[model samples]
Target: MLGEERASATRIRLLRDVGMLFESADVGWLLSERGAATSPSLDELYRGLVRALTDLAALPPCETDSGDLPASAYARVPDVAREVCDVLRVLLGRLAGAEAQAASSPASARAVVRALAAPLCVFAATHVQEQPWSSPESRSAASQLLEAAVRASGSVSVAEFLCGGTPSGEQPGALSAVLRLLRPQMTKESWKRNQATKFVFSWILTRVGRPWLADHLDHVFASSLLISDDYRTENKVLGVKCLQHIVVNVPAADLRQYNRAQVLYHALYNHLYTPEAQLVEVVLPCLLDLLSVLEKPCGSTEMTRRTNRYDQVLRLVLTHMEMEYKLALRRVYARNLAVFAHRMGVVMIRHLKRLERVIVGYLEVSDSPGEQSRLSILDVLEVVLQNTWPRVQSRLGALVRALLKLMCDVTADSGLCSPVAREELLDKATRCLLLLDRYSEGQIRA
Candidate 1:
């Protein structure tokens, strides 16, 4: 009887504290009282107020006429929501405190975090979908809550939720309720709809909803295909970026489950070299990095062949680089040629004859006084000589004379050159002289 009386007292105290914390005047005054207090006890009290309010925010939706609330009460809702988010933001840190205080194992801390997550997500989603407050602050709060839920539930469940589906073990009704709450605010302009689809793709690559993703691969691919040409550049670029993330971060076994891995590789490769596509600067480096990862030699045993799907992808990437380089030389501005050469050195080395002729053609017509253009051409020649020295040396006589004449012009007309241009010319001249002497000696020895 005494224990039962103590429990009743505790419940009554909790209810009283919740009512005080949720009062419009108290919440408004608290927001106004910032920077006024430094006492530890006051700080503790403030934290307790936040905890009570968070509990209130987490309550399952009840059928109450929010219109009946006073104007002041409605104004306080955004403030209360913001404060609750601030408190939950510190959850991971507080888990350490829970770990220290508990007599039992620390695993309960994870359960506490998990328990807080669903309620926090629902609360934030409600405010996110609220038409009255659609500002950046509200969106940020919603993103934070959803991101927290993702971290807590693992990537797969989060992906499933984003795609209007639920994980296998979760209660269907509960999931539907959450989705219904968020649906009102999740509008997508036609242009933005495809970009938003990347979140679903990312979730799948993270292994969050692998089975669902696999089952719907045709749908996803078809949607990507339907993306108009203008948007295709950005969407395809994003798609490749996501694929690289999945390829490196996800386990090989997980990636192999989707028979479309090769199809994705081909899709990325095709877009990268498509004649009209404008390649974003970052895409090329990322593609090369993915190739490097995929081409890493396997173990020496007979069962461990170096060639696999990854190798096949690397070969396609190299071929794409080669094609793009040739096309750039034939069609792109001379100024942009250097970037292609530097980026496609691995490809240039394999097709030195075609590349050498292209470089020569660019140098022949580079009679303009623009320092940037001249330096860019020289930069390509420098990379070619450095990486493909033997092949370059075989025809060094013609290339050497071309570089020497350009260097002489730059030195004689130093007034037209920037310091950067002069430095590049001097460096290329010195390297070329050294290579010419070496090649001459090798010819005599032969």
Candidate 2:
């Protein structure tokens, strides 16, 4: 009877302390968001929170047969091992948006971020590793904090929640490669869902230091397609955004010999043809960005590989144009092709010769492709001329005939198409015809 009373008394004290700590945290949070009404300093709240976590970390491991509120978890009790795990679940959950308050308390915010990150890593290292704390509760709570960081915080905050600071531009640290989280099958009860894990883990890998992505690009790319959610579109967006961020932001030195920029390029390039409009929209800029940053002085191998990728981009655009519903996306894709031709010059144009039939097919009177696709094709042709007239340009007779045929069709009195579209087609064709010297010799009046 005495033991029962003592246990009850300790539980009451724990309940009292938990209530007071939470109440103080709430007041601090309220003050942080709104002007003070006798609320405690955020710094003080953080300190109290930190002390509670450390105290809990020092608790005895929870045992299977013990009551739900184990005496071992109660500080100074038999084991006191579960104390840290208990404190983590309650505090970390409440601390969900707590990092947002740090800005209002700048004097303490940085320190608080650091305190949250470094200790949390130590805590994770204990519970998240292969041989971690024996307490299942601690492991579960640690996973909760990780996933919460991804769901609740921005990238920088998430970075601080793991690495104590945003990743620097310096060369990758020896620890940059992630092995622990590379499990083929993450124990879901012990891990975040694949999308969150992939998204957040990819972000974590990038911030580990420069060139960290060079090693894990495949896994990251695969993660984006591992779709099994209602938010699959959103997941792909985040995943592609992450890919673009690393490609554009990796330090030049880090990418020097990283031949796999080609892989990153193709990985995102293939997504451009997906039926999902939103996914296609997100992929265009990333593909463009990848093209923009395909570093110059590329070796023969990379250069040849990139040339094929460029050709593939054009081919995809041309193929998509045949489908009427895809005209809007086709316009964007062709514009990107123009940019590619401008940069790659004659080499890219040579490959495009094979697609002349397709371009003329659009201008043919039988098929009334929209003004957007027609004008965009002409725009691309204009760019090709501006880059360089193919001294060896093939199919001259056929090319001039197509131009003449398109101009005549647009100017025909039977004109069933929009006056605006006709004007655009005529204007674009006139410009394109003027670029070809054969137009003068062939009497093709644009």
Candidate 3:
């Protein structure tokens, strides 16, 4: 025991000395010395020093009454952080081999796994906020270490340790750390579409689907919103996958506890009008699925109210589509006109006219080939029209005229399509005009 104490003291002293050297070492000299070193013993000593430095770094910063640590101390942090991370990389590699060997021996494996959690969590919690150490590569490595530790432990404690607490509360630190680890693996650029889909689906089913995690649905949704377009697409796809899993495995009564429909609506709203092309393709099909589910008539007042939420969401979606079209068209105040038209359609259908008017109005104005925004709007309109057709005939004239003008504008743009396609659009427009002529004549009889 006495000898061990002495050795520990010697190691700490060596770490402090190296820390000081790291603070003052000339870059050129350090590089030259590092390259010239040929002795295996010296190399081992150098590695040992690095490990000690890492241990020292994992120690919490000393609390000083003088406020935050000095700038010089803070500046030394990244170097220490990198050294610790390097040591962890080596340790994790060694641990992986050990873990593989010990897999069959549950008791021994648990001990080995428990031993790893502290350092892995400490490294993650400490350096996560340190910008220099937060590079994608470093963050990914740290995440892998924590994930491995968690897998080996087969307990939630490691997740708590990394995330700081259960997902029930507003603990951003732990959440951020865990998410940082998970995000890289789930990002669109990191995985092919199919692989990304599978990865996120598995993660949701295995990790985020727990009751404890479900309570933090708001955080999950918020994080989904903040991720990049690539991540958002992956996240939405995962949400759909999880929804499918829940529908299949869990009873409807149990699934209803999740407010799955509400969650789906929020995700759909965010993605339906996103500018990313890949995301649009991925999300549109999911939205169609949701619409089909919601289209069934409600049998109870409570169910009816929930169905009304779907109505509100659909209205908001249409409004957004019009806004997108007006912006894309760059017409003089087209946005205001579109908004006015959407509101008019909403009010008319909700109160006075048949739903057919709304469909005609959307189809008319939303088909502009020159307007990328119109393409998406047209999709929404088509869905609504298909589902709510005969109800839309009263407003059909206004709707058809708007659609014809959009078609004309789109076909006029040379960059949008081949001349054959342009002629087809003109023919469609001519047919729309003929319909208007016939409709106007019928109005004289009325």
Identify the leading candidate in terms of TM-score: 2
lDDT of 3 by residue, 210-273 (tens): 4444434444443343332234455445555544433343333443455655565566667655
Cα lDDT tens digits for candidate 2, 1-446: 67855754665457457645664576245335325878655545665665564544343433332112333333342123234444444554455445465545433444444335434443444454322223455456556655543343333444443332334633222222233334452332322322123433544555543434545445543443342122356556766766666666665444334555676676677676566766766676777667656644322344554445555676676666556355556555555555555656655555556456556665553325356656766776776665546442555667678888877767775455677777887887877777776534544443
Preferred candidate (TM-score higher): 2 or 3: 2
Instruction: Specify the poorest-scoring 10-residue window by lDDT in model 3.
Output: 329-338
**TM-score per model over all chains:** 0.47, 0.49, 0.43
lDDT of 1 by residue, 45-108 (tens): 4445445655543322223322122333233345445545544554533443444555533455
| lDDT rank order | 2, 1, 3
Every candidate's CA RMSD: 14.5, 13.7, 14.5
User: What local distance difference test score does each model get?
Assistant: 0.48, 0.52, 0.44
Extract clashing residue pairs from model 2: 56-83, 56-84, 57-84, 59-80, 59-81, 60-79, 60-80, 60-81, 60-82, 61-81
What's each prediction's clash count? 2, 10, 14
